[model samples]
Target: MAPSFYETLVERNKQYAETHNPAPTIAEQMALGRVFETTLVITCVDFRLNPDQFLQTKPEDQFLISRNPAGRVGPALQEIMLFDVFLGLKRVIVIHHTDCGGSQFKDADIREAHKSRLPDHSEIDHMVFGAFDEVEQSVRDDLHLLKTSPYVPKRISDQSLGFVYDIKTGLLTPVE
Candidate 1:
């Protein structure tokens, strides 16, 4: 039998641990001072968009990333707040992309699909999947979300930026 995905991940991790030099542990970050010199990347879960490649991030780069289906900041606010409180975030980069699956459907479409697929699960009727109409507008909206959020500090919020990663061109264009 083939190894499960989880088993493959574990085997890969074992190989990774052998050669990779990781960034500072959370304890190291805490001992260093109040703010960590880390930039946080909020990008899509799209398979083609790798922040490491696009951002030119080396292992030593102090960048942390949090990814969701569409890279929507609304659902990731708690994560931002928690990371800021604990590890400290020097910057927040929101990167939505062209050809994004998140922009492909509306809430109604998913809700209807769910109802059709799982008719008995009435609780799935009102679920919000963070679907957005436009990709650039979504990035702008996420930047606004980070800026206006009370839980995210002014220092961090001020440094927040947005971008639209072009999958076809393999480029990142800043989103206003």
Candidate 2:
């Protein structure tokens, strides 16, 4: 019989816990200590990729936000950043992984795929290149957006950081 998804998850969690040392109780959280430094990690929406696994940071230590293609931080992401900045978050990490779906299809193809479902008057603009086109360039653009956006605290100009991850080797290299 096949294992249930929940069971598999529990097993994985148990394995992780055993490997990382179990702190099953909330009292252990106090022992773990609080993470006050604010760091934002942006990555793709791919279910296979987890920013936390790469970060290897404790839970609640940093904000991990994933976007499609990892390009152009969307409105929701901006809101999170705004909240973090308000709360005094100073570091930002933008991660774009290899072989992104957003980089797989051209804008016209994407638009065409949704044209029938979307309203005729919808002002949807698609990207020209897919994930493979220019991931490095995309990371650069997103970094600039976070750095220059009026919503972000100006003090973060020199402090925020960006990184790119290679899914193949599971390696993370700095973008800036």
Q: Which candidate is the best by lDDT?
A: 1
> At residue 37, what lDDT does model 2 achieve?
60
Tens-digit lDDT string for candidate 1 (37-97): 6788988888988888888986456788888988998888888887887665788999999
- Estimate candidate 1's alpha-carbon lDDT, on a 0 to 1 scale: 0.86
lDDT values, one for every candidate: 0.86, 0.65
TM-score per candidate: 0.81, 0.69
TM-score of 2: 0.69
Candidate 2, run of 10 with poorest lDDT: 123-132
Per-residue lDDT over 1-176 for candidate 2, one digit per residue giving the tens place of the 0 to 100 score: 98899999999988888768543465565467753466666668787687767778785574645465544454335654665655457666677876666666776776666776775736655433333467777778777877667777666546656666788888977886
Q: Which residue pairs collide in model 2, if any?
A: 103-130, 103-131
Q: Local error of candidate 1 at 84, Å?
A: 1.8
